[model samples]
Target: MTTPRLTPHAYVLAVPDLTRTTAYFEHVLGFSRLWNDGDNWQALGRDGVRVMLGRCPDAIPPAELGDHSYFAYVEVSDLDGFHAEIAAKGALLGFPPRDQPWGRREMAVATPDGHRMMFANPIRA
Candidate 1:
């Protein structure tokens, strides 16, 4: 018997407003809306990245308000170009792109529902 390879397909996030959050992913992040339950759940994809949004206000605690500790890191081929595109779309950028000590160029932004997303790319030699 041979073992099957494993891969990441999607990540689900609890959001307060499903519709608003879904729209953010679609418009702001350039993700295509793949499917929706018409109420509580929605799935989106961009390039090969997939994300699912669930309507669950109670799942997100109140104390950890605006910009919670949870963050999603996305690897991009062109960090500067990606940053420029999203910034032109009015994205709420946490900071401009900068080279990190770990040899990656990164920029962070927050979604409408307060989910922090970090976009990064390797610093080429």
Candidate 2:
């Protein structure tokens, strides 16, 4: 049987401050701003991983923060290295890398606005 192929395009996040969020992605994650389509809509990140920040009038609605749902899992060649980088850069929530039962080595972190971003690498038997 052939496993179905899948690809991710983008993720939408509601932020109180677009400028702050954009700057965080750039200065910390090394993401370059692709474009800002006015009013709170900003496209960011690179290489197929894009993060969209939308301005919210009040604090982010409860619906946006679904059941601990993560936007995406970014695969990096060096999770341990990135972990150290983010830690040094003062990521909101940084942790050491660990191998999980699901068969992946990962390190999870969150932005100041509470957006959880995870970097991981597939574990091979």
Candidate 3:
């Protein structure tokens, strides 16, 4: 028997305001506007990475707002270059890229709705 291959298609994020969130992803993160339902759903992509933004007022409960309720960790091919580009675009970077003990170089940023997004690449030996 052979194991089947699985791949990540997209990430759906619950946002309170789809329009604003969509714009952030497009302008700040350099994601191209793919499509939208014109109501509550929008999709964005960049370099094979796709993210779906859905309007959901109750997505993050009030109580969870104080804590890390949602986060996405994406693997990138050029972590340093990507980080520099994002910074040049004036995105609010949570932190600069740092090498982790887990053998990944990672950087983090927070969305307007407070969702944490982390971009990482395997550290080369």
For model 3, the superposed segments whose C-alpha errors exceed 4 Å read: 61-67
| Per-residue lDDT of model 3, residues 23-84, tens digit only | 88999899998888987899899988899988998676423565564467888999999999
Model 1 TM-score (2 dp): 0.88
Candidate 2 vs candidate 3, lDDT winner: 3
- Please provide, for model 2 over 1-125, each residue's C-alpha lDDT reduced to its tens digit, 9 standing for 90 to 100: 99998778788888887888788888777778888889768889767788888887597643368646466678998787777876787776546789999999988777767777788998756
Error of 2 at 22 (Å): 0.9
Q: Count clashing pairs, candidate 1.
A: 0
Clash tally for model 3: 0
lDDT of 3: 0.84
Displacement of the residue 36 alpha carbon in candidate 1, Å: 1.0
Clashes of each: 0, 0, 0
Tens digits of per-residue lDDT, candidate 1, 31-121, equal 9989889798999999989999889977764226655644578899998998889889888788989999999999988877667878899
The per-residue C-alpha lDDT of model 3 at residue 27 equals: 94
